[model samples]
Target: MAIVDKSTLLVLGPAAWILLAALLVLAAAVWRLALEGSPAQMLVAGLRALVQLAAVALVIAFLANRGAWAFAFVGLMFVVAVWTSGHRVAPSGRWWMAAVPLAAGVVPVAALMFAAGVLPFNALAIIAVVGQQIGGAMSTVTLGGRRVRDELAVRRGEVEAAVALGFQWPAARLMVGRPVAGEAVLPSIDQTRTAGLVTLPGAFVGMILGGATPLDAGLIQLLVLISLLLVNSTAAAATLWLACRGAWVREPA
Candidate 1:
């Protein structure tokens, strides 16, 4: 039976659940032993994944074939992305400013895809496409923004030294933090570079299982990867720009 068949999920149902639990236990064990991390955190994350996916699946059931309502759902997803990424960057309630860089990454690519007729306006396609892009943007924003915050915090003296030497704080902060912020895109870069060699990404594997030809799967995966690269790099840069402009500064004046 095809892995992507609708009934396959039901067939594999209990087995899949058990497999996921086993994997979670292994991860939790590794976390506890290798990193001295809390096993509870790992297990909790697994549980959250189960619950959240179930909830999302339920929502998608209703959202199916609901043309413009999909956009509304995307808006909801964007808000969650912004909030989560913002909190990740700074937990001190400056989270709202995350919208700027997040938008910088997600919107242009989405608009381009829709306008170019590359992506259908259907609920499934729109949600899948924009959801992944938004996820990419969120991760990059969190990484870049947090790097800027933490780097500026620890390297406050460098910022001060630059400021003392006739440079402005913003410029000095940028000089110190931009490099770290720039590193945020390295993950996406490496993922793109190593795709098919190091790992079959979910999109590629899923499409293949869904009966798409290998070439078609590869092309779609390439498109997804390329789009993520654009969104992530742009988000990282925009995060840096926002940080330099003082969206978040862990260093005191």
Candidate 2:
């Protein structure tokens, strides 16, 4: 069946709520059993998602005009992305630097897309495409930053040795951090490669359900995938560079 099927159960009404709650409960149970994860966290996250999506829908309806409101909302999203990504790597409060790498990754690609008309500069389309790219940047930078933090903590001696051998402190960090941080883009690469065969991504499926031809949906999906690669790779590299400069270096207790 096409994805548009199961409208009543999947899209609205009581069945949708029940099914979502059931799935969340099942996931929480499995996680709690295997990893002692907090089931409450899972439940809360689901609830938060429901509330946030509802809020987004209502807010987006008011942002139909192409004006300052659209750009302001996207700016808010960028700030949130930076904060969220930094929290993952810098629990000790050195997170503000996260904006650098994330901006480095997102700005260029977004400008290119806007300039090339790949994404129109309207409220809905701008948010949909730029938000996705910003999310990609956030995730990549988080992974890359965390890897740098962990590797430096674990391999402190290696970094120290390089430093003692007359290498600069930044270079020493780079020697240890680069290898691990570089793996940040691996997921994007894998997802792009196995996209249509293993899974239909949200953009492609959404467009198809919205009445776009399959070919048009596929092209859009392809564009999103390629753009994600650029965003992920650039963000990861910038994160690594920033980490090497001591942005996310593990602090001593």
Candidate 3:
């Protein structure tokens, strides 16, 4: 079907349902004292996210039909992922340099898969896989970046002491980097271990809902998970290398 002909299955009045769910969640948070924000901010953020997702959904559908548009959308996703991931990791103005490792992880694998015909050039599938890769890159970069920054900040004195004694940046980083990288891998490792037992990932559930065979859904989810693991590991390594190289250093002031 063409984009215009696709029906939005409004299960239980979309906006009203979302609003009710947000209200319920806000009420529960307040009742339980689970959060620190004003309920109004939560409500506003929920509404804004809903609006943004709706707009993105429409744009994605349109972009999926145009080859050039699909590539453009992928580029945009990568740029946003890099910026947000970098900001979350180190909070340095030079955090943008973290994009190098993020790209290092994503672009190589994505290019290989696309070139090898493992990932079809279809717009929808391309978008889906690219989005997953971007998400993986973002997660790795953000977690690893923050961990490294926090580690260095908390141990700067020790690091400086080592440096004073003639230890280099890479050696000083290695002293703390291993632990941070280990922590950064926990999310992916946990998600993989808990995939079908404790949680049903979106891709698998969506495929089942769309009438895919259980085996097929399982295989697809496996592919996604494996791809994510590789991407995350690569991104984490890249982040560590860049941070060690002083490319993403905190400001001296």
Candidate 4:
């Protein structure tokens, strides 16, 4: 079947609403049982995703054919990803700090991929690869930032003690935050390690469904996995460093 064939679109049309409803129902259950107050967030996130994805679909349809517009589109995606990640980590003014780790992770890898001819320097290819990399980096940054922030908040005494013991502020913060922040990469590590044995990622399955050879698909998936490792690790490290420097800490109440 074609990737976006009529049948697929038909399935997606209903599936979207059904999935959104299911998510809201699940969130409501959590809210009622666990008193988590997540139902409203779930509803808002679901609606936002629906609208944003619809917009992206229309935008891509128009821009994909225009080679000159590809970079602009990719840049927009990066900016949005950075903003979303930043906000996810910290809702306050420091949310923009996420841009540094995201760029640190994605830009270097994307540049190297293009320069080494691993990724074709074309609009579609760049968008596909760099978009995924940016997304992975964003996830890592969010995870790492939240982990470090929470750890520092909980272990404020430990950090203070280390500081009083002559450790610098950054070192004291890292002493308390680095270990937990490092956990941010665990998911990517597990996904990569279990790629073929436990799960076939979307890139591999999509390539095969798109008529690529299994070997080619596997190679492409491997590249994606490796790139994700680089991106996520860099993002996690950068986020941890930033957290150590108090770049994303909330003000005391």
Using lDDT, give the best candidate's number.
Answer: 1
Which of the two, 1 or 2, has more TM-score? 2
Q: Model 4 reaches what TM-score against the true structure? A: 0.87
Error of 2 at 167 (Å): 0.8
lDDT of 3 by residue, 206-227 (tens): 8887889999999889888888
Pairs that collide in candidate 2 are none
Assess every candidate by TM-score.
Answer: 0.89, 0.91, 0.84, 0.87
| Model 1: per-residue Cα lDDT over 80-185, one tens digit each | 9989999898788578888998999999998998898989879988899999999999999998898888888799899999999999877998899877987889
lDDT of each: 0.88, 0.87, 0.79, 0.86
- Cα lDDT tens digits for candidate 4, 1-253: 2134642213455666677688777877787679857677767876788799899888878876676788898889888988999998888859989999999999999888888889975677777898899989988998889889889989999999998999999999988887898798999999999998998898898888788999999999999999999999999999998888878856577
Segments in model 2 whose C-alpha atoms lie over 4 Å from true places: 1-12, 249-253
Ordered by TM-score, highest first, the candidates read 2, 1, 4, 3
Model 4 clashing residue pairs (backbone): none
**What RMSD does model 2 have?**
2.9
